[model samples]
Target: MMRREATGEAAPRTPQAGAGPVPAPLVASAVLGGAALLVWPAVFNGYPLVFSDTGGFLHQTLGPLMLWDKPWIYGPLLHAFHWRVTLWAPLAAQALLVSHLLWLAQRALRGTAAPAAHLGLCAALAAASTAPFTVALLMPDLFAPAILLALFLLGPAREAMTGPEAWYLGTVATLGIAAHLAHLPLALALACMAFLLGLPRGRALRDGARTAAPLLAAIVLLLATNWAGHGRPALSPHGATFMLARLQADGPAAAVIRARCPEAGWYLCAFADRLPMDANDFLWASDSPVNRDAEGRARFLGGALIAPEAQAIVAATIAEHPLAVATAVLRNALRQLVTAGIGDTLGDDHLRTALRPRIAEGFPARERAAYDAARQPRGVLREAMMPLAPLHGAALLLSLPLLAAGGLRAWRAGDAVALTFLAMVLAGALANAVATGGLSGVFPRYQARIAWLLPAAAILLLMPRRRS
Candidate 1:
């Protein structure tokens, strides 16, 4: 093992002939223990956590309706694991995968894969970060951080991974990207960083393309699934509608509607008086300008029906007020970066009415009963998670200086792996904020899902370095 010291120099490389391969049983036990820690929130909750969008994803395969805003990938993923018998299967799978990735990262950063060290890292993150909560959730939110870790492994820590491990990470990255629309842009940004960071070392083209391979694969999967399900090769069938909702919430689209109303004659023009609303209201509220009908009944299809008009409105708004649009997007992204909280992830009061019926339809009696009795539905998980907010905030705040110091130290020591890992983490945070916050509305869950990585990176950076 080649150890890096405080000074900008490598200590003598030592051979470890006696340090043989770790026993398979020990590795399995460590990973299972880590997985348990990662999903502790779910275990404590008595059921896997779900969200309003979980129903939409479930319908991808379990129900007849094909959701316009959602892709078909994650729904089938849930069905594959749970077989409609238990939601716990998918949650456990996600936790195991996340735990394995964390273990791999720890090994790459610390140069050892001791079970105690791996479990300790997992325990610390479980205790202090939102990672356990994110893992427990049945939503694709867990994949956000999983994608970041996968990219870091495949990019900065590439040399440390075995051939099979690299393949597995790439597969994880591909699935993570396909799980949610926001992940595509996040993955692309990280891949671009991988290429740019490799330039000085003359591996720019290879590293960039390698890192981008999963993104390309995810795109193909998305297109194939969309076409199979909706006869559309588009990545997201009604993606423009979501963007329009976001733009309307931000005020630019409303301005366009108001200025062009009664003449430009888009459906939105009729609601120019109700110009701007919260993005969620614009998309989901029964009386929203977008979803309300002449009789005041909810017309959910209005969103899909207005998709073409939404695209036109979005284009016109961006063209007419480019500066306003840019400023609003920047503001939203900044807000998204800081609004990391576990509240939305646990709070199901608003979603219960709509989400419960889907749970009943999709799951067996036992599972449905569990869903109804879950802490989220009973309004206990939110209270249980309240104490974690300050701790998570403090962890994120402390990570700032620690990450900066770690990056500075790595730079001075010429630790390319450490430098690249830190850069990737920072870039991932920005990319995720821009992708989710700018495209969708600013939501705490969007940022909260990935916030754990900040502290994880700080801890990984502080780990003692070893040769790849």
Candidate 2:
């Protein structure tokens, strides 16, 4: 039996090293990938097939195809094929993207066999663990990991790039923009990293421009496509209006307060008992009488407050209640790391029950009543699982310490790759916490995206260094 080499340690070079048998890391990654593909579907069989807001994404993409002849819906190229083939499109895209990301990781870890192994293991675990939440979702969260992984791979390449690499980076940045606007931050972070890493001033500027240009172009393409297809851009008015309204409400102080208070519901304050509220909530409630009337509705929209008014509120809060705001932000960041009791599993159950009586009085009366009665028992399952939810929560809680240790070890070792990995993870978590205003009704599934970073970083730090 062949012994597997320990991670990050270099394998001995052979006379036929360039043409030797396939690397061990690649083989392990393949096995891990295969296992993920096999087991994920079964584990999450009863989970909802439709993700929250998947309908919105489908509407954005497919709605255009139904209405006009535009080349794309939101990006430079329309995922027209993807729109038509709904059932398999999202899954297929995820698989291909993940495979590409893993290959890129392999390339990034070329010299350090140990780091490569660690990254491979991280990829495998991420694939398996996150699949239940990410795999079948129609939203952009699934695509975020692939973009982040690509950024991780490209971090080291910044130092050694020629013209072609710049173009490649530009293309990736374009894709990142098209995939999700949230990912634009990662692209910006990379450009900042290029400058900080001491690439020649001229080359750094050139490379940065090259990478950013495509993203800009993609944005333009997105706008133009929307303008040509729909009378106006599909995203502009709605997104802008929602953001503006959020800003006008409680401001950033409200956002800060929301972040600190983890008990606030996702879109309402009713689901979780421990949710927090402050002056911001008062201000928000005051401004949006409609939201106040609806009660639980506005809480979900809290994420939109990241714009100007919210920023001003946050700034003022920092100035006035600096200590309090800082404490809240930190606390929220911590809460975001754990798989706490967030989301509307119970709320969903109650809503389902209430709707049953209404369905009995409405049309399609027999079928609707039967469906409701059948699902009532599943609500019992949902309740039963409520007690066991803490077990999953504990697992997430345990991983954080290990991740912190890994992060510290990586930082102390002066490993740029490790540092970048940690930075990306922290940035993502911070962004989510600050932007979303705490974890309140956040679903456990969302944590799947960045959860593997801690273990991956730890593995890299623990892997033995190869002889130079």
Candidate 3:
């Protein structure tokens, strides 16, 4: 028998090793796959500036990059370079982000013998579901997937994180929040997952606080910048009063207001326009005439409003029909989710046409009109899907099951990564619902907002596993 040097005992032979090095071919394939995704737009050229919101986002983000007197708060990376560079910036950023997500999938499935196959399948599903829509756009949709991947990669799993990993996760969380308020829910879900995944509660809370501090600071700084840019607070009392007045109006008119303005700061008018109104809606007929009155238009344009009167009217409506108001809010949240063009330009073809004559550089009228007409089918489908829209409300109604499934899966067997993902899907769905109200006539891009969660849940359900 072989004896140990010091203890004079037989040396024990190690059992067959379970974990293996990541295969070189797998690494090469992943790198190649990522490269393909990065260059997909240039190669295909099928969807350049296709989404309606792309123009606005490009203008907002690239305008600041060019040192134009536009608000930079909306585009955090605006100061990083010249706006002209941003013409290609979205493509490059999206490519890099897609690459990173592919890398994360590799890591998530690292222990599996066929990590490449696992990652390839994940990528395929992600692409089929939402990755295509996101990477194809110039809007913040790409950031959603990037943030989710960052969370999955940096989030604490069954294993403990190294100091660097913790710091990286924190940074990703901060950036995710700053990217868009919509991303906050995912960030929160990640934080919860970290705690549930064996991280000490105190440490988890501390990490969360550290991660959130930068986002809060950035938000404050952005608010200051926006105030300076606008020459006023983001939302002035007059603006608020005007918004309240608009909110008190009926839905059809509110839809018209949103169609015209499309700016969040003018959200009140948009909200009011969305209020449910029949053909003979006479409650706010006085307000309707105000739209045509020069003095009334001047008051609205100048942001001077009868604040108490508007508030009193809205308050009275709520008081008289509390349940109805609550129901409306809920319905609006649902509307917001499946609505196509609430915050986009898809349905704003009329507005685009109006601006075409005034602006030397704008979408060509013919193209804009065609795009608007093309959107009708999507609108019809949305209306047709109205009965099925509540199926999405499962995110709200069955939040507990999803949460429990996600939580339990993340727990007992250390397979909760899927749960974390589903949590985000549900959170985003709920947030969109709350933010916008039920399906507006907008396109389906908003549904892409939570696209990451779909494949994640699918992976959880589809992946073969030994029973615990």
> TM-score of predicted model 2?
0.57
Q: What is the lDDT of candidate 3?
A: 0.43
Reference-based TM-score of each model? 0.94, 0.57, 0.58
Model 2, 398-443: lDDT tens per residue?
A: 5567667766665455444454455665555555444333412234
Total clashing residue pairs per candidate?
A: 0, 13, 30
Q: Which candidate wins on lDDT?
A: 1
Clashes of 1: 0
The residue-by-residue lDDT of candidate 3 on 275-294, one tens digit each, is 54432222224444333232
Ranking by TM-score: 1, 3, 2
Query: How well is each residue in 1-468 modelled by candidate 1, as lDDT tens digits?
Result: 444454333332222221115576777888889999988888788888888788777777777667777777788888889887888889989989988888777766655567887788789899998888888888888888898889877766676677778888899899889989999999999999988887776667877887899999999999998898778898987789999998988899988889888899676766888868889888888788767865576775878888889989999989999999999989989999998888888877566665777778878898888887878888888898888899999999999999998998877776666777788889999989999987787888899898889988888788776553
Off by over 4 Å in 2: 1-43, 46-49, 65-86, 110-132, 158-173, 186-190, 197-218, 229-235, 244-414, 438-448, 464-468
Provide the lDDT at 35 for model 3: 42
| Candidate models: Cα lDDT each | 0.82, 0.43, 0.43
